[model samples]
Target: MGWISHLCLMNMKRRKTRTFLTILGVVIGVISVVTLLAVGIGVRQEMINTMIDSESICQIRVTGATGGKHKDRMILDQTVKAFQELDDVDSVYPFYELYVTLTNGKYSYDGVITGIPQSELTKKNYTKTSRRTTSNVKPVLVMGDKTASLFYNPDTDQTYDTAEKKKAESWIGKKMDLSFWDSQDSTSVRLEVGAVIDSGEDTYNRDSQSVYCDLDVLKSFLGRLPGGGTVYGQPLDANGNPYKDFVYSGAVVTVDDIDHVDAAVKKLQDMGYTTENEKEYLDTIQKYLKMIQLLLGGIGAIALVVAVIGISNTMTTSVFDRINEIGVLKVLGCDPDELQILFLTEAGIIGAAGGVAGVLLSYGFKGIVDKIAVKMFDLAKGTQIAMIPWELAAGAVVGAILLAICAGYFPARFASKLQPLDAVRNR
Candidate 1:
């Protein structure tokens, strides 16, 4: 080791108790900063992860601009096709939701059915135990994984209990009776379940407890025939003609990337359609997180500022006590710069030691806090409410070292400028 480092070590060793006290103050400050900042980071990350996992980040929900005044201004085919052609528009799916009663044998469930374009439904979106041969007769269907679970016969716990693991194999190919109110009439339709999908890990996945079918099939069930003239008792227009065109309750436009959501929403709004994007909610959440981080960091900075003052005071006292030593060094023709460096090095060592201890203690404290948070908030096990990035850890250590050097600068300067004779005589 160099003389400056060696001398710093010796000085700290000689005044172990005093050095330890100084390091302790820094340690407390670092711990406070790391832990508080970590909490803010952790909360922000959790919220973002939730949005991503729930598949809400890139999906934009667009509805009619007329509110409830004109229900028939439903999103039409040409408009959907136009939206699909837009830049960054990966895909567009028309949504039509209706509260329906699904029945099979003695079991029945009141649920919502959402109709989406059959051609756009990707195989990766669902799992089919047995792929049914394409036939014009059966109306193909995909049911949510949770929705399939409701079909299990509670009387016999055999196949139904284990069906979830098989990806709802028992329900595949079975015809289900669906009943819903279409305007003034109560309508029913029988559809076949072609596949069952894993809607996500969350219990409240939108598809859970719901069925998905071709948009055309759903429209037909509602008495709106595709080819024309109110055959299934569809509502007539003012001209006493059946509405042949398909009308969507809403349209879900997915952007190619999350960053492009604002652009897509803006374009849709300019076209006179009301839209809602989860990114808006995410933006609000991010602002709140920034505020929280600032509040936490400010609280911790106050502690660090106090520690800096303590370090400055300790170095000043050390300079006074080492007056005779400084005089001997000056007599030996030790450079003024070297004297200043030695004192600064000593402070840096104390800060480094404290910073390392504080970081380790912060991690341990984080573990305890996470455990308490999980239990108190009923969060999933292993969920950490405080997260400390490597950048923060390294920065904290480096910051402490720099702060110490700055704090000790004036004291070191005073010691370096001391005259050999005066220092010796004063001592």
Candidate 2:
């Protein structure tokens, strides 16, 4: 071993009790910081999981223009075409919803419907569970995975798991009669079920609980079909009229990539369109998350600061015990800087070792806490309350070493300045 390292080791070993106690203090401090940091990270992640990815990051929801030059104009085909040509735009889809009554023989049910182009209903991420089969006889529509449960034999129990589920499974390729009441009259038609979407595991997995039909087919049979879900639905127009040139209330504008959402949104806003993108809201949430993490870290820092004092105290005591040795080394021409480095290195080693042990223990403690939280709380299965990222783990060890070096500075300076005559006489 190098002389400096050897001297540091000897100095620390000479006061094994004090060194061990000092290390213990550092370990407790590190455990407190690392575990709390993990908890903060975990909570922030959970919040992100709950709020983010619920909608497409690159898609924006746009309503009728109420500002700029296109004020008070209705959203229509031209608007979709205009949006599609904007910079970074991938595609734009115009859609309208309806509260309608549907029937398969005697199984009549009330539900919601969306009229969108067939091109839109066929996109991979947007929709695509079962392949669509061609049939020239009648227009086809796709049903949600759960929509089948709405139509079932009345004589049998209407439970979703029983007859409803079995009957819903048989709805693929079947014909269903649909009716919509407009402002002036009622219109009806029959539509075949082209395919059924696979069940969604989450809440917002692309129309997983609704129905969608070709816009052209729906327009032919619709006459100012009411909007909204209530019995007294919101009317789209005052007079009953055909939807050959219907105006859309809102649209979904998709950007080519997530990196282009800002540019696309700017273009839309410049055109007097108001847009809402879930990704834009994430920045606001992240601001609050940073504040929470800072608070948690501050609480843990209290313990770590206390540990720094312990290191300082141990180094100062070691200096007094080794006065004679330090004086002899100086008389033999040892540099004062070397003595300082030796003390700092010794303290740093103890701090780093303590930090490593604490990190390992923090991981074990996290596992225990997570299990207890899952069992005692209403959290979903496999939920974690504490999570230590690799960045945090590496930082803790580095921080411990730096803090120890700082704590040892004063004692190292004191030892380096001791006069050989004065130190030898005192010994």
**Candidate that scores best on TM-score:** 1
Which residue ranges in model 2 land beyond 4 Å of their true spot? 39-55, 65-72, 99-112, 123-199, 202-211, 223-244, 327-334, 360-390, 419-422
Candidate 1 lDDT, 1-427, residue by residue in tens: 2988887888878888888889999999999999999999999998888887755689889887323334345477777888899999998878876666777765566666777766755532665544662334444677777665565455765333254454454678888787654434455567777777766555555565567777666665555433344543233456666556655667999898888999999999887788988789899999989999999999998898888888999899999989999999999989999999999998898889988999999999899989999999889999989999999999999999999889999999999999999999987
- Which pairs, if any, clash in model 2? none
Write down the TM-score for model 2. 0.72
RMSD (CA, angstroms), candidate 1: 5.8
Best by lDDT: 1
lDDT of 2 by residue, 254-324 (tens): 88777788888888887777788876876678788789888888999899999999999888988898899
Backbone clashes in model 2: 0
Q: Which pairs clash in model 1?
A: none
Which residue window of length 10 is worst by lDDT in model 2? 229-238
